[model samples]
Target: MNTKAFLEPMGSWAWWRSWFLIFFGCAVMGTGFVLFINPYNFVPGGVYGLGIVFHNIFPSVQVGTFGYMFDVPLMIIAMLIFGGQFGTRTVLAALFTPGYMNILTRLVYPDAAAVESLDPALLLGGRLDLSNDLLLTCVIGAVVIGVGQGIVVRQQATTGGTDIVAMLLQKFAGIKFSTGILLADGSVVLSGLVVIGFGIGTAEAEPAGWMLTLYSLITIYITSRVIAYMLDGASYDKLLFIITDKHQELRQFILEDLERSATYLKGKGMYTEAMKDVIFLVVSRREVRLVEQKIRSIDPRAFVVVTDAYDTYGEGFKPLPDADTIQAE
Candidate 1:
């Protein structure tokens, strides 16, 4: 179990780039939690969601600190179950998010009074609190959080906690990943109902109420859509199937210029009974036109079929199962 090699990215440049993206994602997500979501107590899911619940009960403890309380144990569990395949990058994400969240909390709220003032309240006896712009805050905060999470996932890392729970459920219960995520997050959301409550206005105290819960669900939905869009959205990448006579030349172009490999399939034309070489390859949407142009140059009559590839994973693309998984295999 030499985890050193598995924990390290294949090359130095790649290692640094992955870390940069992971940290950047953490910062973005943390900022959203501190400035927008935390102020209003949205409880959007993850360890942070639980943090908000705890914060409501115990205002003295910081949400980010509570996140750490959940994350460290989850990290340990991930290491034990997934081993090196769980990756050091995931551990970094788990730690970076809460750490940065604490940093952002301090920067935004320097004193106890500022933190206490975040709850929904009235100003000057009759006016509503300006900071309680629920709709706009939820939408904007969801977008920010979604994009940040998408970036971290693109690096094949996670911020731990419930994500680990979802993975374990998927592994042992034969549950799909998406389903597992929904179930886990949905449970957290339901818990929020109890923590935040389902009520309207009260003269004595301001409760989170059912309305905030509904708004929280909206934010979660928006965040999921944004994450989906960032991850693979429509037309992000395409699978090209080119049937042409100039197979060798096209293959060479793909290998050399495109720096991508292709698969060649032998086929016979139905009408002419002539042999044909079908080339199957994938290219980013940005590179589709160039690849098409190259194909035209090589063979004017080549029949090309282009289809969307939502997500692609494998060597030369996404990494294979983590090092430990590969070893076990």
Candidate 2:
């Protein structure tokens, strides 16, 4: 019998438990952005941040709310790939975050809130209305947003955002959740830098441009790291499995040109029933192309497989070596 088919439906009690997590996560997502992003007009991370930057660059062109604009499309895409719990969870997060942010916007009534103790350095910076204490905003905002995000992920829920796209790509696009995340998030950050510079007034436009650039970069970095950590797909590596007749030649090339090591696994082709040598090498993702080129040069018919090894261990992988150690090898 199929294990899931044998399982019973989740009860209302279980349903509410998930909703509770989503609600809290959404609340944090909303409140933190309002305090940090909107007040300072700092762009959001990923697509949301990109929207802000886009508006800044092209004042006449108005996209919808950043969260909602990204959420609807992203959730739809995620649902198509993941289905069921994963899809539903992302939809709820995507929808709820924006709504909650709107509600929180009204509640906070920026004018109504008693003057909270802001950092002294920010007031001294004199960049804008809140005072240009970018350091405080960046660090505090990351912590505040990251905490809520961590909680939701721990509960296996989402805080909305482009995380839905990341999840979808992970399931169907044959991509890691973290890599997709950086792409989605970084995509927004990059767009924002370009868009935020559209206005005419130097005083108004200059600050927006600077803040948008800074916010997009930092937020994308923070969110990407946080999401990858939560989802267990965070790293910077490419795992290469090369099956070649030229074993010693390929091995030496990596050790010398790439400054890497390989483990020779004696494998066999199931179909051919012929013995083969498979060389396993772990290198930075950027170096994959070069490695592949060398493999082709040495053995054109070699079977090469490249994959995102989210995390790796052992010699010549990441905790890395000095130039001397690499050279000595």
Candidate 3:
């Protein structure tokens, strides 16, 4: 296994950046849980989702404390099973996130009585109380949580809840990672349906049993999509396939005018039986017009195909993950 990612020189910019992302990401995730997810008892998955389910039964114990109860043991088991591949950053993120959640809960609900009682009405003076608009709340909460988790993942670390469980399932039970995650989170969501939705652990039964389940599914879907968007970036990059005769001129225009690069491929027209140069270029969405105009000016009959470049990585684009980072991941 490549160790360079985890063994980055201490005090380097990469090291500092990784640390910052971990802390900031964990804080944002905790904030999303404390303010949006936990108050509404939305079990969106992971240890926190289970914590929310259990919180209904034991309101006195904060969700973050439950996170610790679940994560610490999982971390130890993961280390034993996977060995050093776990990485220090992941362990730190897992440990720090729960504390952040617990602290944020305390800060958000200053009144001890309100906190212990798990009073949703007392949260943030009801500023975030969108109990009336559950859908909107779920979307916003999912986005916040997804962005935070995305940042942590980008730094080659994880918040380490159900992720470890998924890994374990994959290793031992021959379950696919994604499938394992779905099963784990799905169970947690189901638990919410039973515990909170059915009023099994509450003073009264919630009327929104199936509705809560649906909303939780929506939350999970949106959160996953947002996290994917965060990691892969916006699909606003345009890839151009230009079939033109003026290769030199177009190449000059791309290099000097556009400050971009392109690859040249030799091709032949099936009908014409003539050799040609295919210019493969990738540019931002805004640059497509300029490129098209330049191609037209150079070769009016240029056959240009433009498509979306969802994610690009290289010297000019996003930097590729280093070996150490990749291995750590």
| Alpha carbon lDDT of each predicted model | 0.73, 0.60, 0.80
TM-score of 2: 0.55
lDDT of 2 by residue, 147-179 (tens): 567557655656556666565565566676556
lDDT of 3 by residue, 156-237 (tens): 6678887677666766777754455667799899999998889887887678777888888888877777766766665668
lDDT of 3: 0.80
Off by over 4 Å in 2: 1-15, 54-64, 110-130, 172-174, 198-204, 229-329
lDDT value, residue 257 of candidate 1: 94
Clashing pairs in 3: 5-324, 5-325
TM-score of 3: 0.85
Candidates ranked, most accurate by TM-score first: 3, 1, 2
* Residues 248-297 of candidate 1: C-alpha lDDT, one tens digit per residue: 88888999998999888888989999988788798888999999999888
lDDT of 2: 0.60
TM-score-best of 1 and 3: 3
Order of candidates by lDDT, top first?
A: 3, 1, 2
Instruction: Indicate which candidate wins on lDDT.
Output: 3
How high is each candidate's TM-score? 0.70, 0.55, 0.85
